[model samples]
Target: MFRSSALLSLLLLAIGGYATPVVREPSPVKLPFAVRFNNGTNGALNIIEADRARINLIKEQGAALAEKHENVHKRASYSVSVTNEAVTYIASIGVGSPATSYDLIIDTGSSNTWVGAGKSYVKTSTSSSTGKSVSVSYGSGSFSGTEYTDTVTISSNLVITKQSIGVASRSSGFSGVDGILGIGPTVLTEGTLSGSSTTEIPTVTDNLYSQGTISTAAVGVYFAPTTVEETTNGELTFGGADTSKYTGTLSYVSLTSTSPAKYYWGINQSIKYGSTSILSSTAGIVDTGTTLIYIATDAYNKYKSATGATLDSATGLLRITTSQYNSLSNLVFTIGSKTYTLTPNAQIWPRSLNSYIGGSSSYVYLVVNDIGSNTGSGLDFIDGYTFLERFYTVYDTTNSRFGIATTAQTTATTN
Candidate 1:
């Protein structure tokens, strides 16, 4: 039932709560995430190379979606901790009654939730097969299986009943994780299910609101920069934004009208290296599935020239000298009327983990890379994990806007 997006530029959860006499306003549900680098089935740990490959696949997913025209449509106070996999965020989700917890990738790029890439699905009394086949192709990974509805548990305060999920009969590219928790737009689910070409599946967030488990259909994501290989430094807040996690007020921008980029959690932004405008106001996406900040090839070239960095053949990242690192300019992104800046220290990869990506300990590496294409592609840039680590983000589906604000680590020299 699953076909590769390469064949199609194409294609592509919930929880509940209890009652109280106090009648307090529903609080946002929170989930924690940690970062871990996948070693691949061959036991290799080249994160930079792996991330570059993933970027290509994500672009492919966007391109496929751009080719098709679609209408865009748009939580609780529970907290779950997640691990920050260096290249991906991992969260444990429980499925079925008497839930069996499975480690899943918390991805906002793709929207069809599935399992069985690693752990087998455990059917419970609440499980029901929809009799329809389901499949989704993530450029780096894919799964083809049957569609089923069951109870999905996010936290004690957050649970969704009769939520749809894919039970994978076959999968690939997802190692060390059970499957994905897609938080992207529900329209992306079109064509992912048999006999449902025009039907759009309700995402975990959508069901949460419809079921009255949360007051708002939104998710606030927070990630802090870390130097270690693995850490519990990220959280997913369902229902609404967590004010305490961010410093200033949240500023939201409407989703861009541009194609492909607009298909996901996309926005319009411009980038500057200090005072030089590298990327003009353009459309792109803010993706949790991507590891680094990627811009158009020409913009990347300008950045490389400005920073005096060379391509590191071993890691596929821009390499620079210590002196150049000290002289680096702040990479500023102007979204709407607000500006978010990445300090010079925030531009480099964590030096402590240099060896993990096949780089020398003494060499300095920049996290910015080329998107492998030019600016007019619609999806000309990707503000990935590196950028997310410095800001608080809100995917406000109910309002059809993306929100960003300063965080405690916005100017941290952690890297």
Candidate 2:
């Protein structure tokens, strides 16, 4: 299992780079009830509640933000099932009832959300451990499950109605997750299955948008600490877009052929340490499911060189000068044309394990960790925690393409 500390600290993702990154300022909108969550030992994200002025600012900017990205489509919304004890979202399918859901890693890095099937057969065969080898081959992880499809359903008061769905490939850890949810615009449906024979392996985001499982076409996600008791961790809004719950600004990032799905969002334009700009125009992805922000090789090198520390490249993770990281000012991102900035403390990531020479153990040292390439076919461009929690965001898909908006959250919106 991926450790909480490891998962929370860095933006570990695949690499894909094409265009130059943009830089800008953050939306003036502020969310009600400051999002309070522990960042483990390093520190917690001390997000304060937004003031009345900020709220008014968001209202003023809402329309222009909405009108900015009129071409982006709202991807698919998914049904999350609790098969085992774990939570996973649905991916895509191959043949037969491809609608059946499988355990997936809800990743914002990769635009495509896919599932694993051990030596696959008909829809009714028992799931075997054959996927263990497959997992090891891909990322040294495997899946376990049994072939079983059941009537699945998900609903939200903000959504159209109770949404019905299907589930298959019941597994222990693999199927435990409702299936991975990729919070990007491009659905991973384009490229033909490269190494595998799976044909229905569309980008999870694409399939969800293409399918009518969720009413509104677009979706929204709000995550709190595991301690906060709630039936749903976040909301995936469908059909209509709600401004009451978001800051109401939909920033965008241009996509390239290498971009996952047909198009991709979540690209970061810049990052800063104090007044010093480290990554002037770097590419990145915006993933809510990811706890930490991941950076590319060049950016990581520049940051580490400036800070005078060596970061490991294997895992795109980081542990900078704890005090410097905590004290830094706004960490910025420039999407398509708009720029969004987060307070400095938000960039402080916890070092899960004690640092040691490379091993599989979580006990790693503290230093700026360098990730893989973000140049080609990478999720490194997606933005994560540093950006989302501060604003009330909406995925507006009603007009084919989608854009984000800063919303005004009066009450805790439930999923």
Candidate 3:
């Protein structure tokens, strides 16, 4: 899994920016799709090795995102499942009239809905090339290909007419999957298309809302904690959130205006480890493409010191003793007017899957890590899958705000 910088992330899904999802009918249309996580491998690397490599790559992608500001999944037809392949989330989607199925990575960090990374793009009566060259630079890979408008079928009930898609003639860094189903903001597409620097291609969600297939330009994402390589523990809803997937109120926060991060689904929030402050209110993003909860270097240091965790070379994650685990405090995130908590049990890596990442079964690994810089950077923290797994998130493009709420997994000790 490669990460894209700035507004350009996806299709190796460098997984960076998405598009503007606007609103239409007051009535919401529910389109459930299928999302699977790929916890499989990359050539010779096992699941854990692949995860570490992917994690390291995302750091590079984040740095690149800060520098370039451009490049940068789920189910439901309304269904989202996560399988473990390359440690990235994959979504199964259909394109063309006959509805050929393709497994694309579900990436909220990007908005380009393209295909042809692994499976060849199938052209039929519904496929039309727009004559525009599409390209995106993921930190570890890149792709440049022709652009096309095609009929996209997420499910029998949800179909998008003339959706913009990239068909890669040449691609590197993606394996076992097609291109990304970018669901990020529309602005990020500014400089991505070759020969069309200022052109903005409409994303799948953008078309869904515009077509009145859904009431609003929003997508609800749900992820459940897992220890196995694959499971149907994820869900994606288009148009509006699935009220059944979350508990309590779905609090909303306006997107942050900070640079770099502002180009994506950015937000502002603060963090605390128990009673002590760890990270001050700062701007960052919540990403489905990212796999961990990363904070600025300074905050990470404080967390490491607070928990007395030592860096584990084998897994590239922090390790703690049983005693430390017992004494660990809840890590709380304050976003907008609400505070969400990550219990100690929720902070540790899924213990049952320790061996997958080359960690001892008895070892306790912490998922929170450093973003390689201090706080105060335009983008300080990234609430990755680790954080999202404990909460239900809503990307409301219509109102220009994001939503978050606790879920059944909020305090799960399954780890």
Candidate 4:
């Protein structure tokens, strides 16, 4: 009787195998994002101040990481929606079995996915504590909490099972958002969790690829210039690039070998204000978290002089007259033999939303700012979203390279 039952079980297993055919690989996913403005401590809007603070924190973090010995260590067809919060890009992600959607900042600077800054995390059947504590400081804000692994639902087609997430018990600096969805290099996750200093946490992109949700371990980012304070003008594509979003072929550049900058999605690039060079080829990073473009202090001084732009005390950005604006030269960036230009209109902040950043709508403000430090810092320039809005970017981890291409908005005079 035991032998007969075993034969029957084997037969049923064979039948089940035949019944379920091979599952097809997932396709690239695209996530739409919007723009929002977070009010300051005084209940007024001041994006420049907030952005500068964040930049300072990022520089400090990079420098500290460099001091420490380096030990650290998807493609789908569907896309998730994200928001461009004037200063920060946000995405709504669902967690747990009975998913509770939380608004998270889409950051390419850090790699520790967490929640519970603005909304408390809700535990469900799929939530399990990892018995480890996690904490991260973002210069302007921070959070400390217990680590938990749960089902993270980025979208219907982009779900990740047993993903590690920090449930913040205490957090500050993120008043409007719940937490950050870190999509930077996995190495950035090192030392953020307790009990294991060397163990790096897998980011959302990591899990998505490992779990067979996407074929490639890459993310393509597209951002349209925003003239309003709030609008959906960005997209995050997982697994692969959306070829339709870009024009011409995508140019690739290997990650920089320089330290600190190498710790993130670092690259080598030079800046030229029209025919004149400002910042020579230097190691830096491409960050989605930053609101404006930042170059070395020396480079900024040169740019200021060339554009005839004066620092505006009111907005803390370079102010130019209509005549200067008309004569404003294209800010050209050369990365990996490819030249990307930010036209005069693209260099200035959105005139329509000038008041939102505490600037007079009548006056023009340039988006390029000083990095507070000169070159040779290993991390000299930061091509922020302002630069990205005009190009299509691909963060290809499997290739250890970054890709860029011109887009329809590359020369748009929208701003």
TM-score of each candidate?
0.88, 0.49, 0.84, 0.89
Q: Indicate the residue-level lDDT of 374 in model 2.
A: 43
Give per-residue lDDT, candidate 1, residue 111.
80
List per-prediction Cα lDDT, in the order shown: 0.79, 0.34, 0.75, 0.80
The best candidate in terms of lDDT: 4
What is the per-residue lDDT of model 4 for residues 1-415, given as tens digits with 9 covering 90 to 100?
A: 0000000000001112445753444454444455566666455466566666666666666665665665421111212122222377777789998899888888888899999998899999999998999998775678899999999988766788999999999987786788989999998888899987678999998887776666667888888887866667777778777777899999999999997789889999999999999999999999887878999999999999999989999878999988889999888999999899999999988888777777886789999999877999788998988899899998988789999999999999898
Every model's Cα RMSD, please? Answer: 8.4, 15.3, 8.8, 10.5
lDDT by residue for model 1 (311-387), tens? 99988889998988989999999999999999998899989878877788878999999987899978789999889
**Alpha-carbon lDDT of model 3:** 0.75
Query: What shift in Å separates residue 258 of candidate 3 from its native position after superposition?
Result: 0.8
How many residue pairs clash in model 1?
A: 34
Model 1, stretches more than 4 Å misplaced? Answer: 1-24, 28-32, 40-44, 70-86
Residue lDDT tens for model 2, 1-415: 2212111100112123446432221121111111223221123221111111111221222222223334333222222222121112232223222234333444343333324333233442322222211111111122323222222212111111111112224323232233333444443222213344233233323333344333334454444322231122333343333343455455533442222222344333566654677666644444443334446566666666665443435333443454544444555555556655554433433232122112223323222233344433223344444345445344443444335544332112221
